[model samples]
Target: MSKKITLFAKIFSISFLFMGCGMAVFAQNKTEDENVIRCGVGLLSQSPTIFTKKTVSNVSVTASCSDTTVYQIPVVFHIIHNGEAVGIGTNIPDSRLTSQIRILNEDYRRKEGTNGYNTDSRGADARIQFVLASKDPQGKATSGIVRANGGQSEWQLSEQAALKDKSNWPKDKYLNVWVCNLKNGAENLLGFSSFPVNSDLDGLPTGADSTTDGVMVCYKYVGNSPLSTRYNLGRTLTHEIGHFLGLIHIWGDGFDCTSTDYCNDTPAASQANYNCNTTYDSCPDAQGSDMTANYLDYTYDACMNIFTQDQVARMRTVLCGSIRRKTLWSEYVPQEEPKSVSMSLYPNPVTNSNVIVAAVTDNADVTVFNAIGQKILQKTFTPTADKITINLPEYQLAEGCYFLKVVQPSQTKTFKVIVQY
Candidate 1:
């Protein structure tokens, strides 16, 4: 089993400069636990309030997954432990993990019959897939999972400690997630994503993408298990993966009531709520209760079974860009082993300035995309010790989401950026 990391006090110098500006756009909160859920949304919105409506129905929520191209995602599981086998309750069964992956495909692509969330079950089946890597950072094939014994794992702002040997996986090839026994007050915290395109691991050289840390329950309650249905539902991974792909909670942070979860389509709830029998209306001024059914909310697994079209669009944007896009359906087939190039995007979610691109080896042309899958920017970078910058000022992009791609000689890197108005 992996060692758990604490989170009640993990601090990173993130900007709160615009936190107060968008409080009025959300619905009124019903309580505190709900507020914690809502605070998760607080991180998603840029507006003061989010509007809603009863019009959003099952059809609106259903996503299309007609495209069945398998997306091959190189996965690296970091098993942090104090003194236990890497494969513990925390380590989900491979069969269960595979089921969860299938769920992601079904949900994201809206596969029929398996649309557990009751939303429209149609779209390019994200044709994407994940595999446990057989190689380590040293160029050895791995089981896509890593295990380390003993380490101080805490999410405290300043004490964001790293394990003893945290540098064995290669970020450019694998989607790294550290799984462990979450320290006190960290369970339900599940996982959090490190903004992609940034390789600086604040404390260690763990250039992985997101951190999936939590308590591992037994088979009766863990992955794909109905016993622990609510929390253990595949939804936890789906939710965290959503964050990995750049989706915020349905409600913005808890600073105020109006902030959105960053998605223009998702309603802004004053605060996020937990299981509720009564249908509470949030932001009555605008529309429906904050999308409690959204995976980003604090609802138990069974309660969350859908992702809206807008949410789908946001995720597709990541898969379509240079970051995770190429490995997505139609881009990369399972027939051939993928060849990746090293690249980076700077000033993600750029406003007036252009995003800088850096190629690790040889310089290559790059492409940029908007929310609806339209190419907005394109350029080529020459091999240079310094990065090359591409101006997207002409796109005149409004406040929304976007993706950037940079192709290099080895592995390709894609990044999802949010444009703030």
Candidate 2:
């Protein structure tokens, strides 16, 4: 009698064997002893042929400004697990998720009191903040955290799409982050992120694939907890988010020093530094030492501290230049009671010049504040015949996020404006 074959069983056996070998290699590497950041950005650039295209093609470099523009990004965390209750096993508690968000904002903004904040002159407050989305994609109120029973104890890189599909919010409006127990076989594989594939290098539409858009993080590395010794500060997500915002490895994703990360500031290096050794310089031709403290490197979480000024500019360019990312922050117009006066600013996101047009019954005071709430410019305007135009020169103000407040006799109205040089 001819032997019958079960195709499904045979395939499962082969897959299990492959997984076993992968695990063996990972275990032998002693990844925990030496810090390793298994970011999938380099892997994504290799396959599918499309991701390899240069990210900044037609995008022109904006003049670096003393003040960095502040961008508010809405974030949602998707927790995937088997049947474990909240706060058990891979089903992390809400506090842990919230703590991760806190760490991200502190690192990006360079909050004064945090250990992540650096006093070095190169240290920069990215002026970027992350907040839990108050509204869901369906327009319903939400806590910004989605929980799904994936029915799987662990997941691999190949299963990212399956895990994300379990629960995904709109990528354009909110940054979706998935937290789950990654496959133990790939012990060093901490996390990965999909680059902004919504547009091509030339700023043309590439029809970004929604399924593979956001970020995937291992549950153990998601938060700053006592159990997570080396990576307890939650810098892994910070590093992955750097990729999400168009930052490559400080070594330029190559094994040689000839490669460049496209930023003028970051020094050239042949490889990533794993530990907190600040004196290691891999490139002889470079101007400065290796930037192991940079968030884009594979340094230990406690060692990572700053993002250079050039890096801040690069990220802001992606935020405002990329078609999908540019619209992340919707214009918020504050409502007010009916008034006889009307005030407005034209050429918003003003580059070279700006004019404030106002139709008012009386004189008013206008004040401008930087993103950090420091008053930058203030002037009182007296309208002629209920209308007047005021010209704002670009030389006086630096490129960044600002707020304009107009004080009238009846009430005070404030408007948000972006200045790009």
Each candidate: what lDDT? 0.49, 0.70
The Cα error of candidate 2 at residue 117, in Å, is 1.4
Among these predictions, the greatest lDDT belongs to 2
Candidates in order: C-alpha RMSD to true structure = 23.8, 17.4
- lDDT (Cα, tens digit) per residue for candidate 2, span 189-221: 577877665332322224546667788888888
**Which stretch of 10 consecutive residues in model 1 shows the poorest summed lDDT?**
1-10
Model 2 regions lying over 4 Å from their true place = 1-37, 46-69, 198-208, 330-421
For residue 114, give model 1's deviation from the true position in Å. Answer: 2.8
Error of 2 at 342 (Å): 35
Candidate 2 residue 83 C-alpha distance from true site, Å: 1.2
